[model samples]
Structure formats: structure tokens, C-alpha cells
Target: MIPASDQDLEQVQAQFQALVMPHLDRLLGFASRRTRSVAEAEDAVQEACVRAWLGFAGLRDPAKVRPWLYCILRAVLADNCERDGRRQRLVSITRLEDEHEALVGGDDDAVLVEVEGRLTGEVIRAALADIPEDFATAVEMHDIDGFKYQEIADILGIPIGTVMSRISRGRRLLAGAVASNQRAWLRDDGKGERQAEARRAARAGGFDGGVTS
Candidate 1:
């Protein structure tokens, strides 16, 4: 294929930045939650953005920017997994059942109320980390990143029903993880107090709903 002129490349870069740059933090958060290491997440984001930039001239709709970038990121993640031989360890959807079922009992909506009341960015990250990767991906894309179900389905390359199921199951898992006092991750000395302060600050900064668990 013939390369675009420098002027065309410049316009593509400008448009790509305008649309994609705004979502970079969220995308990084997405990658960070999925990957085991910070370096891996950063590498995934870098590769995905490079691929995005290379294909920017073909992107026709500004509104589709977020999903397009996510699609690229997912591909990068899959590639990374394959390269690292982690793909063989991927558990099927059926394996999520036990964890899904563990989310039962105890006043979920009440737990959700407590979670929302004291939600901080750190707490959200922790909760996301506690869930299955697939479920967390769906939840973060739909709830945290504010993508529609259809967009999430497109980005995840799954049926819309599957996306909805994942979001529902993922939200339950997040709520359980956040509300449980027995969680080992929440046991750090005085960390809960710090997280509470962060929550208040987040509210003051207009993060009202706070992850919609």
C-alpha cells in the first residue's frame, strides 16, 4: 500500500490525538488491571497506540474512537499473552461459575450502597484486581469507562448478551470484594482510613456515582 503524504500523516496524527488521547488514562487503567506487571501494561498500551496511529487514517467515525482503541488494545493483550505462553492457562467461562456463585447471599444492594459511599480510585482498582480478567474487562469498559453494551461487545468481540452477563457478574464480584472485611488485601494498617479520605476527596472532585457497583 502507498504511504500517505506528510500532510496527510500530520492530519491523521492530530485527529488521532484529539480522539484517542482523551481516553489514554482510562485505557492505561484498563491495561494495568489486566496485566500482572506495570511494565507489561505500559508496553501493551504503547503497542496498541502505535497500531492505532498507523491505522488512524482508516478510522471513519470519531465517536467510535474508544471502542476502536480498545479493540486494538485487546489484540495487543492477546498477542502478549500468546508470546508469553499464557494463553494456554486461560480458563473457560465455566470456570468463573464458582466465583460467580460466591457472590450470592448477604444484601448485595446494601453492600453496593456501602461501596458507593466509600469508593475511591484505589479501592476501585483493588476491586478490579480481585475479579477474573474477563469479567473485570467487561465491567471496566461498561461502567468505569462509560461504554455502551454494544460498544463493549464490539471491543470484546463477544455477543451483547455475553457482555451483559459479564457486567452483571463482574459487578457482583466487585461488590463482594469491596464489602468483605475478611479480604486480606484490605488488611493493611490504617489503609482503610486513607481510602476513606480519598473517597471524600473524590466526591468533592465530582466523582459522585463512583464505579456503580
Candidate 2:
């Protein structure tokens, strides 16, 4: 790549700071969901930003910047996974038994009430952590970040069809994980309190679904 002029570099830097910084929280959340480690996610995003800055001159379309940056991030994450050789582990809601126990505080009803809000966040996080990185990234970009399908496609350097497939499959996997966990939690006679707590937690987590009966 040709070296960008100083002015051009400055412009690119400014653009990145303005357009990209606001999305750091969302991106970090995406990374955390995929990597299951907040530190790793932060590292991945920082590396992506560095790569973007270094490659800014090669970017021809300013309008495509968001997708382009995301693409860089995706690539960085893939490289990390490959280097680590960590198999993507499927997270099961049933696996949250220990956490659930901790939240529930040992009493049937009180445990349910105590755990309601905390369980939702933990369950959501675990559910998200279980998906494959590619699918998870797509879901994070399209569903969580609210990027359009076309934009997500561009960001990941994949076709829109692939984006749709990843999102569909990822959601299915996440839903299954959540359902499995919820079922396990409800197996006790204290389900009423648990559901009530789940609803309150969902609201606190900013989930529109609120609570389910």
C-alpha cells in the first residue's frame, strides 16, 4: 500500500475516532460474546483498530468505513482463534447450574427471587459465548449493532446471504441455549419466583422481551 499523505492520514484518524469510537462498547460486547473473555475481546478490537489505521489509505470508499473496520476486526478474531487452536465450545444453559445455585441463595422461592435478574445476564452471556465465532460476529454486527444486512456483508467481506444464514443459525443456537437453561431453572417448584425474577432482570438488562410466563 502506498503511504498516505500526512493530511490524508490525519483525516482518516479523525474519521475513525468520530465514527468508530462510539461503537467500541458494542464491538467489545461482540468480541466478548465470541471470545468469552473480556480481555481477549479488548485485545482483538485494539488490534483491529491498529490494522485499520495502518490500512486506511487502501480504503477507497469512506461510506463503507464501518463495514471495512468490522471486516478487519473479524479477520483479527479469526487469526486469534486459529493461533490458539481453541475449539469453539458450545455453552449450555444447564452448565449454569453452579451460577444459578449461587444466585438462588438456597431457598426455593428466595433463591428464585434472588437469582432472577442475575441469571438472565449470566444466561444471555453464556448463550452468546457458545456460538461459533463467525456466526456470533454476524449476529453481533447485524442484530446487536443494528447494521443492515448489506452493511454486515460488506464488513465481513461475505455475501448478504451468508450474513442472513449466520444470523438465523446463531439466533437459533442462542435461543436453544437460553431455553435449555430456563427449563433447568424452572424444574424446581419455585418457578414462579424465578420467572418473576427473570422478567425484572430482562427489563434491567434492557431486553424488550421483558419477562415470559
Candidate 3:
């Protein structure tokens, strides 16, 4: 049995610091939004980090590190869901492509705009809560995290077409939600307490959109 030398350990640690550490905060935030509990999210990310460190030597390209890390993190989450018996209902995507054929919606920009208006963060998260988790993730990844279609595909280990479909369908659903009740929120200025309560409820349900400067 051959143990890795100190030099090999030092090189790997250096590579990890340069390529992986930069993404730690974002990775934690990503896990936090997806997991049901803070403890779960932290544990999942910790597991993923261990996996990544173990596999660091197999990495072929430093540039692709972001997607690689996400792929590992996602696999951890999926594994947890399956063991907990929630995979069939919560993580299923077998029918997403088939359903993509039925996509009907306006441009992504229009829907994103509507969903990003004042009180829109709360509104968008609220609306996203009602849709499939897979679809919500794609939409939020693109609109909130600024991921490109191909990047999302790599991270999810799915086809680019599926990413497009999820984002499109998700936008359609969010738009409908925003338009249907948008006036109610805008029309009432005296409902500050109600709005705060709504925001609190939203914090419990889903991943928050990142604030773009």
C-alpha cells in the first residue's frame, strides 16, 4: 500500500483552495435553499466537500470546477431524498421532457420582469413554491444566480433542452401567479403587517433569490 507523499497532499490542497474554496459560500447558499432544514443543508454540503476533496485529482479541467461541485452536491441531495422516501414525489424528472412539449408561455424576460417588480421577491418565491421543485430550481438558477442554460445543464446532468423546458414552464407558472394577484398587493399600501407575515412564510418554503446589485 502506497500513501500519498506530503508534496502530493500539498499540491492537492493548493488546487482545492484555488479552485474550490472560492465557491464555498455560494455552494452553502445553494444547499441551504434546497434542503428542508439548515442542519440538513450544512451536512449535505459537508458531505459533498469531502467527496470533492477525495476526487479532486480526477478533475480534468479547472475551469469546469463550478459545475462539477454542483453535480456532486446535487447527487448528495438526491441520495438523501431517496433514502428518506421523498425522491419519487419531490425529485422526479422522468416526465419533465415529455411535459416540455406542452410548454406555452411569453418571453422569459417579460415573466422575469413581472416577477421581479416591487414586492416581487416575495411574490416570485411564493409562486415558485407551488410548482415542481426541479422547474423552480432552473428558473431561480437562471434569473437569480445568473447561470447560463448550458451551465445549468451541466450542473443538473440533464440535457440543455430540459433546462430550457423547465425554465420556460417555470416562467409561465410564475407569470400567471404574479398577474393573478399582483394588483391585490400593489393596491393595498396599508397591509404592511400582512406583507411582513407573507415574507416570513415565504422564508420557510423555498430558496430565496439573490439580490443583484
Per-model lDDT: 0.68, 0.63, 0.66
Which ranges in model 3 have alpha carbons more than 4 Å from their true place? 1-4, 87-116, 119-127, 177-213
TM-scores of the candidates are: 0.71, 0.62, 0.66
Candidate 2 local lDDT, residue 83: 82
Identify the superior model by TM-score, candidate 1 or candidate 2: 1
lDDT of 2 by residue, 91-197 (tens): 33333333444434544665455335444544555455444456666776776678999898877778999989888867665554444456554555756445544
lDDT string for model 3 (104-124, tens) is 243555533543565355555
**Strongest candidate by lDDT:** 1
Write the number of the candidate with greater lDDT, choosing between 1 and 2.
1
**How many backbone clashes does every candidate have?**
0, 1, 0
Clashing residue pairs in candidate 3 (N, C-alpha, C atoms within 3 angstroms): none
**Global fold similarity of model 3 (TM-score):** 0.66
How would you encode candidate 1's per-residue C-alpha lDDT over 70-154 as one tens digit per residue?
A: 8999899788766765522222233334444444444565644554665567677665544556787888888888899999888
Higher-lDDT candidate of 1 and 3: 1
Estimate candidate 2's alpha-carbon lDDT, on a 0 to 1 scale.
0.63
